[model samples]
Target: MVPHVLGSGPTAPPMSTPVDRARRGKEARKRLPRSEHARWLPSVDRADPVGVLERQGRDRLPELLPIRYGRMAASPFAFLRGAAAVLAADLATSPHSGLTVQLCGDAHLLNFGLYASPERTLLFDLNDFDETFPGPFEWDVKRLAASVAVAARENSHSENDVRRSALAATTAYRTQMRRLAGMGELAVWYERIDAERLLPFARTARGRRQVESTLARARRRTSLQALGKLTEVVDGRRRIIHDPPLLEPAGAADAASLRKIFSDYRSTLSEERRLLLDRYRFVDAARKVVGVGSVGTRCFIVLLTGRDANDPLFLQIKEARKSVLEEHLPSGPYVHPGRRVVVGQRLMQAAGDIFLGWMTGPQGRAYYWRQLRDMKGSAEVAAMGPRQLRRYAELCGTALARAHARSGDRIAVAAYLGGADTFDRAVTDFALAYADQTATDHAALCAAVAAGVLRAAPDV
Candidate 1:
């Protein structure tokens, strides 16, 4: 089935002026009432969550499948983090404003983090885009809001805290969108959330310390630091260590073909980036397991050195599969899955990785490559207090708004959201309700593992 691209072909704008566009957007709310968002009950024949996961596992490494299940089985929040496909199926049937944008697809709270820009400054934005695709703007927002409630529950916060944090997120999104809509097109495109702009959001002394500490830690995670920790001198040559199941040496054939893959990947970059990358020479590669959702997928870390032995670079080549949203939404015009991820990320991120590139593997599988660790850090959501969580939620909303404004019609979205609490309240209600569903689904996952229907390797 061919997926139709959102906002495709030449179509007249709803209005000429920004104010008129916003007004038209507000008018759209009549057909798709904000209250429609309050409906969160799954349909009688909704797709089974476990079945979707098991089907996805077919395309991944057999040995690491148990680890993926174990991670999700840890908590409801963990399950939500890895189950973008499950939520995509369910959200496809939900009410939308008919407005579309490049979605984060899995815009949970943990996905927002601090990463370095080319200037070495810490910029806060959405860090994961494995499931990124063109979809209704609300889907990303809903997923983010629902995650707040789920995380709140996991942290043992009161019901009021959950509702408050969720509401704060939507409110911040709406407010920021309205502000961005008032700016010029180029101005909106250039807007970003860096550390300097993020200081006001830290509400307490502890929060301030957390921010400073996270930034300090991110700046220190350079390739040199990774080289020292992940590799060792063996017989006078630096080699990656083998820690079975987590980090194992690639097969002889896979290692031999990596040089060609690296060459093909370099060709995808711009002339300047390619020139910059030419200084480094590929050394060795190892099969490595990564994030919870990406555990079973084929991930390899390639070690490279430049000029001398002290100068090192680490590039992570991760398998890119069809987006979870593809079945439910229009797929972009990209033949290779790696291109889809690369293009989608360029469209969404304020500043992207310099080494970002894509190539097809020996088996014709698509993969994208980027620096393995470049000042990236995520907040400790599990350890956050209620106040910190609410503040973090606000920051996430702001970051998401900036991303959508760059890809979608900001004026129209602002109009659709308007200067009211109706949509905010409805989203809060939906998040709370969905958090309940997540708990129930998590229990079912535990049951599946206990009944021997699924295997799980916990604490890995």
Candidate 2:
């Protein structure tokens, strides 16, 4: 049974004058100079990256491990996307700003994207929270900066352009944080980046057109659209289509387990949401593969009908394990892993899915439920040129700062960053260094596959 533990609510920062907050920030700078962040050298005893991945995969579905390795082995950037635990360990070795916030623990570029708000408006913000936990805000910043560096290098940007892209991310983060520090509490809480606001960041006509296309695609990615693509009529009954390892029909036992847990998940939702969910009757389910890091986890997509066969809703039930950052940082509030993810996501996102909820399934595994497709769209980083990459990096940085401002001490963080680009440059340097480490790590993974130390299914 899942433990009945009461989670703590968000606490406001202690009452203090702006002068005191600024002083606190300055003091932190003295303790750990902003320039000190520029350093990054792997320890001689650093754990093998492949071994770390093997440890993470032990608790996952064994058959799916090959697919996880295959997806991560595709590129250095892809490896970084799947190796959040490796990055967490590396970040833990260095001293941090000590500014606590609910981190998007795996805040890579692909994790930030377009999703529909409760009001059906498209908003860009952090969309993944599998690793979300309260930790030094700099951890997420470094991850974002490092992702930009890795992606720029993958696109064959010049060394200077790569560094410039990383710098743009940190620079925008520092500047936006400072701006948020000067805002009223409610104003900072309400701040968001609407999809329309993204147009101004596009420097050229082509860039603008690309942004428009992405937005249009996101708007079309509702549950209704997924019905046509993922479902078919079998003897007048709607059923999920099979697509082999990526998407396949759930077995009789697995389907029964899913149906049994449906009520338990419904209990976690608010009264209104529960009523909304009750309107949809269960139809079918399928085992599915998802993202790079999450591929091996037990994930299932359930089909439900609302008013009629034409009206459908798809909810995804994904396993939630202990966060990668959990061991590196102090203990968090929630005991149930699924609740931790749901709560962390709610705290960090400007708006979240109404169907978000959690439940403990068979054998005490934790799972969270949410819409499978709700106007979600991600960026195509590989296609971006240097100019477009830098702009996108800046946009991501701004969104990161906004998320941090909601959960961390913006005044102190802004003050520590100061009115200069020192911190920005330091993190940028760290990003380049980490990008090199990631390349070496990716090679190690490939070598492991070649030596028969690990199995890697061909990329799907």
Candidate 3:
């Protein structure tokens, strides 16, 4: 279980030494280097598994930006394609972890989405921590800020419009940080951003209706229900159908190995979890696909039946290489990167998927397993207007601050945020500036793809 957060606030200039006192963070937002090189941006830089990713990233920028998610044949999210390969690596090299909580190292715009908490409450936070680790609070905030600029540009919004939206995001982050700083440790931990609680902030009756519609969709993201839809008897044999770009399967050998590892995978879970699933017997399994950056990586789904065909469960095993954040972090080389990542997710998220666990194969690779399609969904970014985006960004910002507070020192972060707009303004400035860089990076990746330097399997 996650321990309660301890808060701290310090306002001092950096010491010239590497002593423990050197660990005390500066109060003012130091003019962070324009690029990620000067002081590391975050700590994920040191992870090696991310390096394997680095080689591929050197040329795949076009496919990872927001512009691409909206235009699949053209590219992936432009910012993601550009940023993850190198910027995340650069951010990771920085020494900011001691400043606040271990952050979701790559907390960009889309990472925040709905998930059912342990109490069945739908809330949001740094949903993807593939690169999560101890790092500066600002790095997460800045990455988020830059993403807004990129997303706005992709929408064909004017520069002024993009700037306004980006700043709104930054300011929200700063304000929310202050709110969290003022809360008691327990109060902070218990906080959540539920849909019903968000009605007041929805700018319009239409927005409220849209939010309600989203909630209705989110409520349907349960494990049993999702598997029931995805897994069915085909030709008197149980199997999952091809869901196009979304739910494709892996190779036959990989599927076989996944089946063999299910029991061993159960050994890694707690007693209660094992007992909760004792009746489940593996029925059919196959390689499945998911996520933007995680595309092309090994992902699989396992079908299990309890009493009969009507009673079913599905488990997904996703290969967990080190996050882009790991490229700069100082963690000892992880023997099982997937296990390390899943354990980190469990530690950070208030509630995790019930099937959330780890598994290893004979080849000594790690995978993070969760119930496939278990009430899993996201807001359609293409559908929201500017005001909704702003409001949603604030929610994401607040939730991110809350997530940080839980894993690290909230008092110190609050103290660092103080009662001003310094942090917010700083993030806004950094975000707009970085967006320019990401756009450039995206162009570079596109060139590489055109030149065949990077493989472009851009499936819409």
Relative to the unseen true structure, what is the C-alpha lDDT of residue 453 in candidate 2, on a scale of 0 to 100?
96
For every candidate in turn, the CA RMSD to the true structure comes to 2.1, 3.5, 6.7
Tens digit per residue, CA lDDT, model 1, 1-460: 2222355311234548876787768876876877777789898888888998899999898999999999999999999998888888888876577777788889999999988998887899999989888777888989999999999888999999989999989889889998998898778777888876666768778778878888888888889999988998889988999898899988888898888788899999999999989999888899999988888999999999999889999999999999998887654667788988898788788999999999999889999999999988888999988888898999999999998888887788888987888888998899999999888888888899999999999988
lDDT of 3 by residue, 1-460 (tens): 1111213321222333323322233332343322221232323334332233446444333334322332322532443533454556545444343464566767777887787765677776557766665555777777777777677777777778777777787677667766775666578767767757667767678878887887788788765676667766678987776765556554578677877888877887789989978888877777555665665556678878888777788777877766665445444334577766776676567677776888777467668887765555576655556776677677777777767767655655565565666656666666776676566556665665576654556545
How well does each candidate superpose onto the true structure, as a TM-score? 0.96, 0.97, 0.82
Candidate 2 residue-wise lDDT at 194? 98
Tens-digit lDDT string for candidate 2 (1-460): 1111212333466699888888888898876799998999988788899999999998899999999999999999999999999999888877776767788999999999999988999999999999888888888999999999999999999999999999999999999999999999999989999999999988789888999999999999988999999988888888899898999999999999999999999999999999999899999999999999998999999999899988889999999999998877777889999999999998889998999999999999999999999999999999999989999999999999999989877898899999999999999999999999999999999999999999999668
Q: Lowest-lDDT window of 10 residues in candidate 1?
A: 1-10
Candidate 1 TM-score over all chains jointly: 0.96
Task: Supply the global lDDT for candidate 2.
Answer: 0.92
Q: Is candidate 1 or candidate 3 better by TM-score?
A: 1
Q: Once superposed on the true structure, which residue ranges of model 3 sit more than 4 Å away at CA?
A: 1-54, 57-82, 92-100, 243-252, 332-335
Error of 2 at 43 (Å): 1.1
